[model samples]
Target: MQLSKKSRYGLRALIDLASAPENQYVSLSNIAERGEIPAQFLEQVFASFRRAGLVKALKGPQGGYQLARNPKYITAAEVLEILEGSYRIADEDVSPESRCYAVSETIQDMLIGPVNQAMETILGKLTLADLQRSYQERATQSEDMYYI
Candidate 1:
């Protein structure tokens, strides 16, 4: 299943936040600039996260945002769910009267269901801290590369 831009940007922003010093409040604009995400779009994404208690926002000159909890406690599945609603590969709704209903049921039972389950297993185990580490590693590797 293809992830929506909102989900992708949200995850990227979260990883950016996770990379910051602990207990630091980072401005959304800074995150948007760092991640190359649109400031307006990131604002909307952060609103959803704020409503879901995934993030906290502060107001005023030093105002910004921060994760509500430790990155290790927040899973990718949870973030995707908040940003994209559902991460299921396919809708289970199939008219039983349709000619392909049986085929569809087989596909759902044998393929879609298992795939969604596996996705859930992987995403559920992948926390924001894990993403942060991965991003840092990649950044480090790229920086270490020498130009010809």
Candidate 2:
């Protein structure tokens, strides 16, 4: 299954949070501006993440959202599921009389299962800290470059 913009943008937002000081609240505007995502969409996406207990929103003078758990404890799969629902490719419902039924089932078992499992394995193992580290490396590499 393809990952939606909500999943991609929201993960970037989370990476911003993961890069911050431990549990420090970060404003939506800041995240949106940095991530180049729409503020309204971010609010909805973050609300879902908050409801899933992946994020926390604070109110008052210094108010915003922060990770509910440490970055290392948060996996990309969790965020993906929270934002994009199940990533698995399900078997289509086919009548037994249909000519493609048997082949379809075999494809689902042999192809979809293995591919989805591989995706799940990577996402489940990749923590937000890992993504943030990747972002940092790219940022560093960009910084090291100079225009002649």
Candidate 3:
């Protein structure tokens, strides 16, 4: 299934925050501009993240948002779950008397189920710190290439 805008923007914003100087409060407008997300939408996403304990918002002039925990301690799956609800592929109960029961069951068991598990496992294992590191490496390579 495709990721919704909420999850996509939220993840982008989180990565931006993770890449920022530690303990620095990043403004929502700044995050929206840098992450290319709309300010209003990012605000909504941050609200969910705040409720999920993924971020903390501060008030006043020198105020903004910061990660509730270290980037290395936060996984992509956790962020996705907060933004998109449960990431489970599907587990709807169907009638045993349905004509397509066997075919559907086979597809879920053999294909969808295994793929979902793999995706979940990968997402679960990937933390924001991992993404920040990758982004930094790419940025460094791009800089070096341009300089050369």
Itemize residue pairs with steric clashes in candidate 2.
none
Please provide TM-scores, in order, for all candidate models, with all chains considered together.
Answer: 0.93, 0.94, 0.93
lDDT: which is higher, 1 or 3?
1
Give the per-residue lDDT digits (tens) of candidate 3, residues 63-124: 99999999999998888888877887885466779988888888888988998899899999
Clashes by residue pair, model 1:
none
- Give the least accurate 10-residue stretch of model 1, judged by summed lDDT: 85-94
lDDT of each: 0.93, 0.91, 0.89
Q: How many pairs of residues collide in each model?
A: 0, 0, 0
- Better structure of 2 and 3 per TM-score: 2
Candidate 2 per-residue lDDT, tens place, 1-148, comes to: 5679999999999999988898589999999999999999999999999999998999987999999998899999989888877877776788889999999888888998799899989999999999999999999999999998
Please report how far candidate 1 places residue 111 from its true position, in Å. 1.3
Which residue segments of model 1 deviate by more than 4 Å?
95-98
Per-residue CA lDDT of model 1 for 90-131, tens digit only, reads 657879999889999999989998999999999999999999
**Stretches of candidate 3 exceeding 4 Å from the true structure:** none
Clash-forming residue pairs, model 3: none
How far in Å is the alpha carbon of 11 misplaced in model 3? 0.9
Best by lDDT: 1
